[model samples]
Target chain A: MVQKYTSMAYASADDLVFGKAKFPVKAGLGLEIGAGYTTPEINYAPRPQAGKSKEKLIKEYERITTDSMQRMVQIGAPSVVLETEHVEQMTNNPSWGGEVAHAQKTIMEEYHDEYGIKCALRHTPGDIREDRDFLKLRGDKYDLLMESFEQIAQNGADLLSIESMGGKEVFDYSILRNDTAGILFGIGVLGSMDMEMIWSDIADIAKKNNVVAAGDTDCAQANTAMFIAGGLLDKNLAHTIAIVARAISAGRSLCAYEAGATGPGKDCGYENTIIKSISGVPIAQEGKSSTCAHSDVMGNLVMQACDLWSNESVEYHGEFGGTSVQCWGESLAYDCSLMNVALKTGKEKGLRDLFTLSDKYRDPQGYVLAYENAYRVGQAIVKDGTDNYLRTKNAAVECCTILDEGIASGKLRLTRFETKALAKVQADLAALPDNSDQFMSDCLTKYKEEVAVFRPENYGL
Target chain B: MLDLKKEDIDGILIRYNVSLEKEMTPDEAAEELYPKDELIYPIAKAIYEGEEDDVIDGLKAAIDAGKNPIALINDALMVGMGVVSQLYDEGIIFLPNVMMSADAMLDGIEYCKDQTDEVPEPKGTVVCHVAEGDVHDIGKNIVAALLRANGFDVVDLGRDCPVDEVIEAVEKEKPILVTGTALMTTTMYAFKEVNDKLLEKGIKVPFACGGGAVNQDFVSQYELGVYGEEAADAPKIAEFILASGDGIEKLREEFHKH
Candidate 1:
């Protein structure tokens, strides 16, 4: 039986520091994450040409893994986590994902044996539900997805992760209109239910295979908001709403841990910081180093409390400096080295404070991502942890209060437009009924008629 | 009442990385970011401030003073949104501000439409959808909104739309252009499938594909594909398609920054 977190794992947020966790996970040749030192987690994707055939895909994986491992050894890297996020084609063909995982893990093991470099292979298969109907998680596609996970784990994957998409149809609709109630239902309630079901099965699979079910990411929900709010894609969503959506996503992502998966959690889930504070699990975070893949405002700030520093994902192709994976891996390794040096010198908190203060005043998203603010949000999340709705709602309200205080104290700056948007978000979140049942009832009645694809049965409402 | 402690003040300053002597008030920081203008300033202010009622009042007053409704939309409302768009580009304003401004601008447009007897016709119709298996549609929504604001009719297929649904919409709507967005590498392949099916049916309605996962290299690989670099670029691309023929090669040459 898997233990679930019922209360805050640490006595205080101050006790929650980088390179340490209440429950550190050991994987692949004595490489421990969240123990006492930080490690680089390098995530890379095969080039588009690899999609030609399974053999080609496997070859590409081998090349990338060998190249990355060789580079790590050359740089005298302490340890690394290599994550293989299977594409749609690989997941559709479960053996393909298994073959790739086996190929990469073989190389990783070889490097560990020959060079004494600690490494772990994290296999993240694609969520194979082609349509938005996540409720129908039983079909050829669903079976293939589950089969891919089993094969990857059995084929030598040390860690299992999936960017699961549930309640996203409603989340998309609700976030467009900045509807707080719809967000609460979609991410908090519906999303939590789906995570429980899927993660419970995944945790069982991990246990059976002697692999760790690392964690799930709210990439579809929180990352979408983060991407949009970062102003690269669209500006129709506000950073204020994005930060709140992130807080709500923390409750949903927490369901994965509750279902028995341990840390370090996925890197892209910006909500991972708050989850780390709550569950006291190791968390992998990506920011400035991930610019090769994406951009965000919290580049420096998100690094404040990360155990596994990652480069998100770089496509395995040649660059001016080197191959994409090698160059980005070096970037991530250097950042991890800096953090490790700080940890060794007992200046980790000083470095963490620098990371926090550099970007904390730049954006409200950054402001809330600061370790202290993340701890406050974590406190709100656990305050009503039993109820998904209340915990997520409380987290959102807490984030808003943090932003308000930051703005009030002139620690953070915002344009008039942003100030107004923040006010609107606060007002909208505050307007929701305090009772979870009332909020659920109101959302069911309102969003059922409003969001066209939000089926009550999908969430088992 | 003023219980000021030196350590407390030092702690606050150190944590925030701000000196008490040089710290600016929130109002002082906001003062420089606000847009300034004369005739159209109030309407534009209403747009950036996201005050819909204020926008409507300003529109009604401008219309009462005998300004052209169409010109008011172009000069006042769109201009107001333009300020927001610029502020957003400069990082002075954020997404929420843009969303509220878009709402206020749309409300102003609707009010203007009601007041004017002769409403201008839209440039053309465009079908927009997020790619199959991808639920992120805020980018698509913004694209549709920008297209509509630029006087183009948009048939948004919403998020996670099936390829068959998109093909069916194209068959029925016969729009001048089609757009798809996908936020994941796994899901972005759906764009290629949609393009292939559209080509199989001999429906080459210039698909403008973009999102976080998509780039020019991916979009340019297929026929009738144009990479939309930003949501704001949607209107310009649509106008180009309306004026110039739907030549995918030319569209890719003109757009697709990378």
Candidate 2:
């Protein structure tokens, strides 16, 4: 039997009913979806609206979640991974760690385990920067955050795709001041500096507790918030994607696309555009596309040749507009680091040059065409490929060359986004406590079978 | 990448280049950010629609062309800022763009001021601080910048400031208005601490307080406190306080019921 792949797809309530979405191809891999009350923004109701009662919120989760999981089974998903949280921590309702295990054991394993279908749970500690209560309290927040991280791991999640918030400054201040609740960072605030400090620190904490650290791109989240709700941020997709792909390439773990509900059109909706800064300045493509489009699907291939950026292995939901096999949508994060661009800015010449591939694949519909093509290749690779170590190394060398060419001429200037990314790969080599250096090796080891087939290489450095 | 001819390259640097993959035109973008009157079209066109050089070059050209410095400030610079404020208010632009615009606007303001003999005193003196123990001052900074943009003398005390420091600054500055921001529920209590101290000293200071954590209920609990729901309202509130003779209580009557 082959090991399961991490490229996940989801089952949305709206799509399962209206779209007649099929099950993601259960090549016996992970089936994950972004949804429900998993993100801070989605669960946290706007102020003055008086959040729903604990009972009502729980009932809503129950309704959406059970239907979603059942859709996985109906679609013949080989295995399922559920993303959830106990209660909306930002709200008045108080629930804690056990709900994670309960969901895993009851909502997930109970039904699928019978058919030898593996099931798991994913968790995003949903904390928004705008949440008033979240901004306060030093240690309780950390303990709560850690509690969720440890709980999911303990409850036997096949993969604990963790979500995080807070900057190194706040983390350090919290540590130095003996303040427990760290400063609230809107998601995707982690930078190269933060990775050097806080990310490694958290990685250490995760390692100590044997938790899997899932890395995600900040651009998808930032763009989603920018397009949907205006705020101050950088919306460059190429720059952000390069940074995230590098981070994952260097061993940050699985590419977790959590949050974002919608994206720019795959074909005719929004014209092909580059990622713009928060103030609406157009820069080159920095990271992922704004919506579920070709750039995003292509981004997965770019990362997958290195790490798990998209779920190759799931139930389909019609709502997202992704094709039937398995659908990995996008991430929804609101990053708040807009103060540093004037001194130096992110420039994306080479990365933009690489995304010319997305343009080339833009036949009929750019994003949709790419998405469909990627899954087709994914299905074939999963089923027919031979697992050989030498062959894997050969494939890895080719991917490395592809990545090298992609980033060879690119640079993200402000806050040193590109330089910092390249530095992270070399710096990881210096062997900080986070084991930043051994990430590529670890990727090779973790997916040796995949390495034989995918021939993954670290494009980060 | 751009493959632009001389015209296209110069095109972007001049007015708001309308072809940068955005749906709206530069003029429409400016109108949406700040929808006041026709006077601001030039400066707003430069700062919002045009690039950084576009903004600076536009201002320099105006000054060289014999436009009065103060008229430029009132009609163009300040008006452009009004749109910047509105853009931020309406969620049309985020902080990064606002900061970039603010920088461009200040650059113009400074150059124009150099051309004049006496720089006009700002609208009023308003002291601002983040409540003690709250390091999240992104909101407070936005308010202080807008206040400065509106020609207010802002004595900005950075975030996590002690309550005593707030009172000390109030005593020293004796500004027409004061503002405090708190992004944490636990730390917002410091707003009351500073207010009560000011009240004890019989300082009829106007303190407007608001942030992620401080609600209208929390802000209204103090004697001199007025709830600041939005940072964009800083200029108007300071103007109101100066006009109302620093009447803190009147803030509740005028600004509330939003």
Chain A TM-score of each candidate structure, as shown? 0.96, 0.39
Candidate number 1, chain A TM-score: 0.96
- Please, what are the lDDT tens digits per residue for candidate 1 over residues A205-226? 9999998999998998888777
TM-score of chain A of 2: 0.39
Deviation in angstroms for B155 in model 2?
Answer: 2.7
Model 2 residue B127 distance off true place after TM-score fit, in angstroms:
2.1
Worst 10 residues of 1 chain A by lDDT: A130-139
Candidate 2 on A347-392: residue-level lDDT in tens? 2233223333333221111221122222322222222122211211
lDDT of 1 by residue, B1-258 (tens): 012233343443342212222244323434444446455667877877788999998887887787888788887887777766666564454454566678788888888888878775566899999987666666888888777656677898987898899999999999999999987665677788889999999987899988876888888888878999788678789889888988888888899787
What DockQ does model 1 achieve?
A: 0.17
Tell me the alpha-carbon RMSD of every candidate. Answer: 6.2, 16.9
Q: Give the clashing residue pairs of candidate 1, or none.
A: A238-B96
Can you write out model 2's per-residue Cα lDDT over B110-208, one digit (the tens) per residue? Answer: 777887796765667889998765556556767887787667878988877888988998899888888999754446777778888998998978788
